[model samples]
Target: MKTFACALAALAIVASAPAAFAEDRSSARKAQDNGTRQIPVCRKNLGTVAIIEPDNQWWREFNLGSPEAILRVFVQQSRCFTLVNRGRSLQNSAMERALAEQGELQGGSNIGKGQIKAADYFLQPDIVSTNNNSGGGGIGGVLGGVGGLFGHGVGAIAGGLNIKKGEANVTLSIVNSRTTVEEALTEGYARKSDVSFGAGGGGFFGGTFGGVGGGGYQNTQIGQIIVLAYLDAYTKLVSQLGGLPENASAAAPPAK
Candidate 1:
């Protein structure tokens, strides 16, 4: 009996090995695909770029996760174009043009699902709201339905359930040659936030569905300000030395 138990344990270990390695490989691939944070390369000459790589993980989850990811795309696109002669440089204008012509970027990997550039900008924006804005057990509202599902009580501390069942806009703000918020998204803000909810219902009270089974609507602003600052920092770095190419985008002004 003991020997058989030992063999069973060994078999369990073997069976679980692939699942563990699969996660590791996924993380490694994700990191590899995301690449590093370096200056952007926008050459003077209009031609092919060699690398033109795209971060599959980030692009899949959320394009332009941080400003750095966007910068990577710009540089890679330049590199790939340098190799393939797809374009001469990287510019907001170029990006906009690509969307106009092909409904997506001309050279970079697929970023956006809808009309959004996905990596560099938002196809839509996010908004905030709540249905339990009443008094009394309104505090219980936030903690009631949805909380029972995701099993997260964090929102409960913030005073009732502040929900955002409304829509969100994705404001695709880009840094100009000056590294300021240039090219205000012409298509207006894209949808930035869209979360689903359904949990925490009668189930917790011996009901089958569990908890407040109808936790609807939530929103995250995505804070346009954060994006603006992120772009500014990236542009500043690219302004100096510039490992890739020339000042196709102009140098960022000195900090005060």
Candidate 2:
């Protein structure tokens, strides 16, 4: 009887272990989700907003195109304001009537004239990134040298030991298009470090080979830092604007 009772107790513990672990994982995921999800302060929807392509020096330097499209993703996700296409052109009454006629044939409602909502605010994003080296030289050099003995490819892969740190700053502004006044401004900053390995080596036959390595560093990319800065800026922008009352009924000038 004693032996049977001990066996049952052990089985019960084993069965309960997985459940406890699953519960822990679930709790952790819930905590992470709560941390990441942004809750808008203003419950009511604000009026439409137009986003302008920023004159991005940082992106230009990196040969990346404008971040205006990326900014749109953040704005739309925030749900604080409706987004309108900046490229939308004004339509005349004749065009509206023609569209309405077409709609009637399709069994759809008539297209009303001047139904397009004008943007109440304009949002502009400015971003800048800089590199700041905090000391140099580490085990990365030794590992790089070892990889160079094998081949260029090996050295390049091992070069990931090399570290570089970068910082980025993003600024977002809200402007009242009608008043031409800046209503709110917010800034976000982020820092990240990247592991890079040196490329280029002599052929396996002759010549000299070189490789570079670095000390231990955080495994973060410069692009990730820039993106984080943008996300932070977006969060701040949303929080700032969400504090205002809904402006769905208000009219403002068109964005330029």
Strongest candidate by lDDT: 2
On residues 1-256, what C-alpha lDDT tens digit does candidate 1 reach at each position? 0000111111111112334555666543433222211223333432222222222212111212323333333444323122322224435546666675675555565444363221221111211112322234432442343344324433543334333322221122232323333333321121222211121111111221122122111111222222222233333322332232243233335546
Lowest summed lDDT across 10 adjacent residues in model 2 is found at 204-213
Instruction: Give the alpha carbon lDDT tens digit for every residue of 62-154 in model 2.
Output: 334455645655555445678877754443555667877667435555566676777878988764333334334322332333333335644
Top candidate (TM-score):
2
Which runs in model 1 stand beyond 4 Å of their true positions?
1-165, 177-181, 184-194, 199-246, 249-256
The CA lDDT of each predicted structure is 0.28, 0.48
Look at candidate 2 and give me any clashing residue pairs.
140-213, 140-214, 141-213, 159-197
What TM-score goes with each of the models?
Answer: 0.19, 0.52
